[model samples]
Target: MNHPLLDQFNQWLQQFEQTGSVIDTTRLNEWNHLMDQFQTHPEQLSSNHAQWIKTLAQNSKAMMSVVEALQDQATDSSEQLKKLREELHQFNVQLLLQQASLPQQMAPLLFTHTHLSTLFNEEQLAKFEQLKSSLNTPQFEKLNQLIESFMQWQQAGQTLTEEMNQITELATQTWQEQFDDSLSAKDQIELWGKIYDNTYQVQFQEPSMQLAQSGWLNGWADLKLAWKQLLTQLTEQAGLPSPEQLDRMIEQLDQQRRRIRQLEKRLSALESGDHNG
Candidate 1:
């Protein structure tokens, strides 16, 4: 009673009519009714092309869905790969920083064991060695901090030494403003005391001429006391070590003192009132 073959024949006829050929709804409806009547009988006709085409359409949709799912996975994989690469780059940067610090961490130990060890204390040597042996993750952290502090101190000491040299040169060259209007009375007094520091004896020549000037004689004794105190503080500040450096420094001071004393004596003799100017 089912006449699927006749059904297909009528469907093909309808497609043919719709393709550039005129179609009449009246005739088409009559044909469709006849086809249905045959199809209902169950023994009219049969064909495989229409069912195969229907199955192909369903398979195509499933294949498209699978392709879209694969694309999404690819995009997700790309994002994950980017994140992993950035993490790797950060790890490399951390490794480089850690590597750079290794030498500084080892310097104190190396300095203690090298020929420079003779210049350092036995306690310092032992401490550095102990620090080297105790570099575990859970040990006392004071050793690491000490090493870092030592490095910073060494750099600062070098910088201070250079600045001190420049200061000494400036002080010596500016001595001509000795005690006049060029520098304030206070500044001149301070500068004079700075030079006389570490020198042997402060000999005054022709004290009578100096006494003749009003207020000068009284100020002289007080200035001498002030100078002696300033010299003591200067020596303490200079932090001289080793008796040899002290001896050499004293010799330099003696030479300058001799020159300044002779100059003062000659000037005082020339200014004498009881003799020729």
Candidate 2:
């Protein structure tokens, strides 16, 4: 139906058959030239012309064969290119399937599925199959739908992740406002229990909420580890809080307090004795 290359093929055929072309002129030129050269020595000239004509005819056949070979090679190369493109397209589809997440991974074997592949009609498939067996138009149409659906799924994931992060941040700030004070071990445990109770009471929409919760100490564990590491580094550098020295200082201060109280009472009793005297 489409005649771009076929018309060109026709035009080339016309050129070959035109005036002064080999296909027509070569047919009788050898005999005519030989006769014109040897009108006097007919026998010898006729023998030599016979040999020459045979050689020329063979050469023409060889030339035509070489041209035909080249044409075959060109057709082969075109077919190879079409096959390679179809392979690349199939690879792209497989890559999409590999990259799909939970919701996206729901639809499988898309090329075989009617809802996805129905977009391609018979003509499109025929054209595609003539090019390569791996990718008919139906497969290609399904590939398009899968890619579109996967992209939408990815966008949805991104939106959900952003919302979760916001919720995590809000939860962190609200908890800090409520319980951001230094408490003893008992009080800390009690407050943590209260938070655990509140978090347990709320129902979550995310099906994977339990998985999220496992990672969730709601960000507290990460913050604690970070600050503890920082403090450890600072304390090592300051060379303070040696346990033996703290205990020794506490003992000496307690002894000094008891001795000073005794001295104060003894002085008060001496003053009363002097007054009575």
Best candidate, lDDT: 2
Cα RMSDs of all predictions? 41.5, 37.3
How much lDDT does candidate 2 score? 0.46
Tell me the tens digit of each residue's lDDT in model 1 across 69-163.
Answer: 44445568555434434433333333322322323323444354311211224566566556656774433343444453444333333333333
For 1-277, candidate 2 gives per-residue lDDT tens digits of: 5533335435545665684455444533543343343343333424547566455545555545544444445568555434433433443333333433222223342233312311234564554344344544653543334343333333343433443444444443445567645797469547755653454344254555544443333232443333344344445458966444566789999999999999999999999999999
Q: Please provide TM-scores, in order, for all candidate models, with all chains considered together.
A: 0.19, 0.22
Regions of model 1 farther than 4 Å from truth: 1-140, 176-188, 193-277
lDDT of each: 0.45, 0.46
Clashes of 2: 0
Count of clashing residue pairs in every prediction: 8, 0
